[model samples]
Target: MIKYLGRDDNGIRKVVLNLFLTGDKFTTGEVYDFLDKGNFEVSYRGVSAMVGLMNTRLGILSINVTGDHNVYSLKESYKNIVGSVLENY
Candidate 1:
């Protein structure tokens, strides 16, 4: 498991990870909007960067390019791990 999963950022990272629990694909903009609607005060770029890190560093999310935007989804293999981490977070 990634050490950074829920270790910092006032639990913002954990909230972001929980977003993937739905098993739906989302672009950065969509993620930002969801967070905003949920009262999470984070920049759109922050969400983008976090998602990027989950893709490149954490290696937990898979990406799909659609038109000009990148869509992200939790990798099937990491779903359980993510769930467990969140459960214990």
Candidate 2:
């Protein structure tokens, strides 16, 4: 967790925004896998926990759960962040 948010919230949000900027469909588990491949060393369970926090506490991300898993996407203005850092955003 970075001291800015003091709760790892910003880091989690950044991860989500980065994935969404990839402009590809990703399931929760797949997203976890994608992030886990990175240098940050976070786990699938950790990603799941952050997703829950984003959904319930921050309300920055919206989700749709169907069949076997849930898909997560963000709300507005968060696009600003995605646009600044992403390639295809």
Candidate 3:
């Protein structure tokens, strides 16, 4: 988890992870829009990369490809772990 999150994330990763804690599936575009609305200074590609890393490296998100987008949600088994980690982080 530490490897995936890195040692010095300025709460951006945590904010992104908190979106998943809502238990709703979201495409990268949706995530980007959410972050943008929240005034987070992140690009769409950056959000895509972060979501990709969460799916591939962290093995925490379950992804479903819909058309050209990949909709992602936090896996049920990792919910508690993710929530606790975010809380403590």
Where is the poorest 10-residue window by lDDT in model 2? 1-10
lDDT of 1 by residue, 1-89 (tens): 45896366577788788888775999999989988998988898888998999899989999999899999999999999899988886
The regions of model 2 sitting more than 4 angstroms off are 1-6, 9-13, 21-25, 81-89
What is the alpha-carbon lDDT for the whole of candidate 2? 0.63
Give the per-residue lDDT of model 2 (tens digit) for 9-85: 43655666567655554566887877767656777887788777766775656678888888877656565654664
TM-score of 1: 0.90
Query: Could you tally the backbone clashes for each prediction?
Result: 0, 0, 0
**Whole-model lDDT for model 1 versus the true structure?**
0.86
Each model's lDDT: 0.86, 0.63, 0.87
1-89: candidate 3 lDDT, tens digit per residue? 75556654577788889899974999999999998998889999899998999999889999999899899999999999998887776
Give the winner by TM-score: 1 or 3.
3
TM-score of 3: 0.90
Which candidate has the top score in lDDT?
3
* Candidate 1 Cα errors over 4 Å, as ranges: none
